[model samples]
Target: MGKGAILGSAALALVSAARSARTVATWRTVRPLPEAPLDKGKVSVVIPVRDEESTIDGCLASLRTQRHSDLEIVVVDDASTDRTVEIVRQHVAEDPRVRLVRTDGPPPGWAGKVHAMYRGVAETSGEWLLFVDSDTESAPDLVGKLVAAAARDDADLITTPGRATVPNSGWWLLLAPTNVLLFDTASPDGSRGKAVGIGHCILVSRAAYDRTGGWRALSGEHADDVAFATAVRDAGGRTRLVDGMDSITSSGLDSFGAVWRSQRKSMVAGGAMVGGPAAGAAALGLGGLLHIAYGVAPVLMSLRGNGFVRLAGLAAWAAQAAAHRTYMVASHQSGATAVLAPVANATFGAQMLDAAWRSVRGGNLWKGRDIR
Candidate 1:
């Protein structure tokens, strides 16, 4: 390698080490999802569903077990052609707290999930609204604990990272590294300018939601969570973003094509699902190059080099791998994944670039609907 290239790789290796340490230090400050009791008023859980037959049953089963006494579960059906609605209907009959709402479709300029949320709000009254994704299995104390934490923080909205896992090993290799992105974006400050959102589970107060026109205001976007957080923060409402850890888990992607489409749907404009193609592409390109330098170069160099280069590369490689592994372990995936940090980093970076392309190139699709 040229002197400049070697120097650049060394520089990036140091960068990776710093970030890795920062990742560890960052989590030390994050409080886990509380297991506290729910003293809060009536809490409504709204789960938006489409063709989710494969997972809806398990999701509802988990909700049925929530220990919160004064909770109502509303499963909104967004014109699913599958048995998703049938399954939710069974839950409605089985549990008094569980109710089913149906929407014909999103009106002229709204996203499916956003519209379903609006319908859910109209059907029942609750001081708190907990939006749960159809694929997550929550702990028994999800509602109460989350509410307790939100109340303590005086937050208008709170979102937490799920214990995200991939059922397929092949999918794991490409997607696990992206887990680092999920935890980092939500914010160390989750208050105003720094407040980003997580899509898995968000607990929001009905007052703040209504005051900010929450769901209705986010009617046109699939990446509604961040926009929702932004709306709340802009309105002088507080948001507390934290790690949910074991309190929740999400089966993020099952199919190969899903990894591609889902990443693109999320990569654009930080969840607004659209952005300047050039800007998106540029960011992706630069990030990819840096990953190759810090995340992949050391691994390859360590295996084949002179005495000095080999030892230096070995040290650098260890730092980069350790960082990636820390992220994998924190997200509840196996640390064994860090063994392939080089490959995983390269794959994830390339995937992000592909997502940037598809996102800006008008190819983003989620749940059979175009997001961009």
Candidate 2:
């Protein structure tokens, strides 16, 4: 009834409606790389590994099951102290399609992963190159489906917002949905400026990669995924972001701390890409604040006896929550995680701010390597 209530209700309705529409659109527009047979092409899967001993074995096990007959798997081991090399060597002995390359270190000014990727690409001769992470587990027909999708869409690069497999820990539940939200919000389209290539499972044609200058172009980036997509777009190549949930999944973080720490470099890079740290931080902070307002404003208005505003706020909150739930379900993640949307939002906002601060202060570190 009051002017304050009227204004608050309008804001809530608009934010809720906008988010709901995006959620529905994301689900409706982005379909998984469909299961289809592809005409045989030499497809190379390049995995850049560090100290991924815990996950490398399962990753390799899944790769060995890929149904594509002409597939070549190149695992480039960056100077790791763990048993990652040993685990990969065991796979090499068993599967002739798998080869292991050891990297002395990254070249001058190159990120470790970038160096490993370049080396891996050099060792393979496939027409289509898939740069996958060591933590990823793929379905037997993943390569077949992705190759077919790239061909069908006439896209040069295919990046996935990977289906993150959360651990049994409740901490994972609180933190994981933030990743989904970030992907859904920041780069809804796999456009040039806002591209979000999930580094864990990126599929790009050798031609497109080469056209974009390949790893060399993105050598300085901490978040190779976004950088890789951006480079492809800048080079006049088409890039598409698809649902790879059916074909691939990835897991690694065992706790909330691990998730937070691991995300810094990529988050910092993301902020840098979207203008600069201050602007990126503001955008992220506003998004999270808006979500919080949607959930909290109604309750506050109701306490102030603004029944109409209260009703609007509650409806908006419910709609926003439903939208998140729908997205999670479509993305093959747990719909239950949607209940923690507020927490996820706050966590995301905080992470973005921290990343921005770290970027301003000077670079950050990933896997003991400095990311500048």
Choose the strongest candidate by TM-score: 1
Runs in model 1 with CA error above 4 Å?
1-3, 164-176, 182-186, 191-193, 254-261, 268-294, 305-312, 360-364
Per-residue alpha-carbon lDDT of candidate 1 for residues 1-372, written as tens digits (9 for 90 to 100): 578656755675676576666556655656666666566689898998989998899889999998888889999999999999999989889999999988888999888888998898887788999988898888888888898888777788888866755544434556555655544444544531446667779888888888887687878767688778878887778887777867887765655666665666676544334355566666776666655555667776778765656666777667656766776666666777666766766777776667656655655366766565
Which residue pairs does candidate 1 place in steric collision?
Answer: none
- The lowest-lDDT stretch of 10 consecutive residues in candidate 2 is 168-177
Query: How accurate locally is residue 109 in candidate 2, as Cα lDDT from 0 to 100?
Result: 76
Off by over 4 Å in 2: 1-5, 164-193, 253-258, 272-305, 337-340, 353-365
Residues 32-101, candidate 2, lDDT per residue (tens digit)?
Answer: 7876857568999999999999999999999999888898999999999999999999999999999999
Clashes of each: 0, 0
Question: Which candidate number would show the highest lDDT if scored against the true structure?
Answer: 1
TM-score of each: 0.85, 0.84
lDDT of 1: 0.73
